[model samples]
Target: MKKIKTNVLRLLDQQHINYETREYEYDDNHLSGEHIVHQVDLEADEIYKTLVLHDHHEYLVCCIPVMEEIDLKKLAKASGHKSVEMLHQKDLLSLTGYMRGGCSPIGMKKKFPTYFQEDILLLDRVAISAGKRGLQVILKPQDLIQYVNGQCVDVIR
Candidate 1:
């Protein structure tokens, strides 16, 4: 496997955040977060999916379990907006510098308000993307929240 230097890894290292990298075979058809949990040999509850959402005017980042779905009404309440929608897939790369399946909450073109499913705090460690398909960064959930200034909210259904 070739080494991939992702911005997410750099930021974590700079902050002295302890983490482990888990890489699996890349397959678009089998790369959902649920599948990643199995591929990486981790629990589904400990792996998360990063979603970019828009309330029409601004974007917010939401992290939820791969096996769960975000309730838009809850997301709207969390964002203090009337409605919340997932950002268009077409706009992902240009706006956040991440492709659809490889978006990590940590290293983006700019920082936006971020939210994590409150359930993350229950786990000692959580697995997120390494800013690339087929790679995961496993680290303390507390470290991630502190590093990203993320809010913990109950927006997942």
Candidate 2:
């Protein structure tokens, strides 16, 4: 299979960051995290999904394991927002330059404060969207956090 390149992959290369990519089969109509993990063959804990949320003033990004859910109250406190809600699906592409299932923390059109689930520190490697669907980038969790200027916080439920 041919390697696929995306904004996320290119940015990692430009920064000389070490990472690997996994391509999987996907259907546009069924873009669930469960399907992604099944295709990539990684434990749910090692695969993360990016979420974009806002408190009306600014957008915040969170990367949590596929099997987990974000605790909005905790995220609000961590991000210093009184409340936060998911960014609308319609605004995701224009704001982040990626679709719902393909949003990666890195290489967004504009940098936003990013957070990763604290437990990610326990994993040696993690897989995140490659800024596109059906592909993932595997790298050290710390490296990913550092690149996105993200901190690990208790954002998962």
Candidate 3:
């Protein structure tokens, strides 16, 4: 199978950021919290998913552990917005150039403000979407913060 061009990888290369990529069989509709854990052979808590949300006026990106759900109110306050609502799938696609299952914190069409759960920093390494289904990137938390200019906050409940 041909490799999908991921902005994450491109950005990493452009900035000389180090990362490791792993690929599995493409599943197309594999966005469930459990699938990623199995694919990466890691505990559910060690993997994270990115959610694209809009506070009506601006877009924000929230990264939280796969095992947890984001508290919209908390996320909104953390992002400095009055309210937070999930972005539609179409909007997510148009804005990030990635489907729901493949949204990466790095390399988006635009740099939306990013909030990451503070607990994620405790992990030595974590797995995040590599811009496509069946693809994942393993990197250190610090590397991700530096690469994406993410703010560590209590965005998850």
The candidate maximizing TM-score is: 2
Candidate 3 to truth, TM:
0.91
lDDT (Cα, tens digit) per residue for candidate 1, span 1-157: 6877689999999989999999978788875666777688999999899999998799999999889999999988987889989999999998899998889999989999999999999998999989998888999999999888999999987
Report the lDDT of model 2 for residue 136: 95
Candidate 1 colliding pairs: none
Consecutive 10-residue window with the lowest summed lDDT within model 1: 29-38
lDDT of residue 112 for candidate 3: 87
Q: How do the candidates rank by lDDT, highest first? A: 2, 1, 3
Better of 2 and 3 by TM-score: 2
Show model 2 residue runs off by greater than 4 Å: none
Model 2: lDDT equals: 0.92
lDDT of all predictions: 0.90, 0.92, 0.83
Candidate 3 lDDT, tens digit per residue, 1-157?
6766577888777877677877756665765787667766777777889999997889989899987999999988888889989999878888988887888888888998888999988998888888887788888889898778899998776
Cα RMSD to the true fold for all candidates = 1.2, 1.0, 1.9
Error of 1 at 114 (Å): 0.3
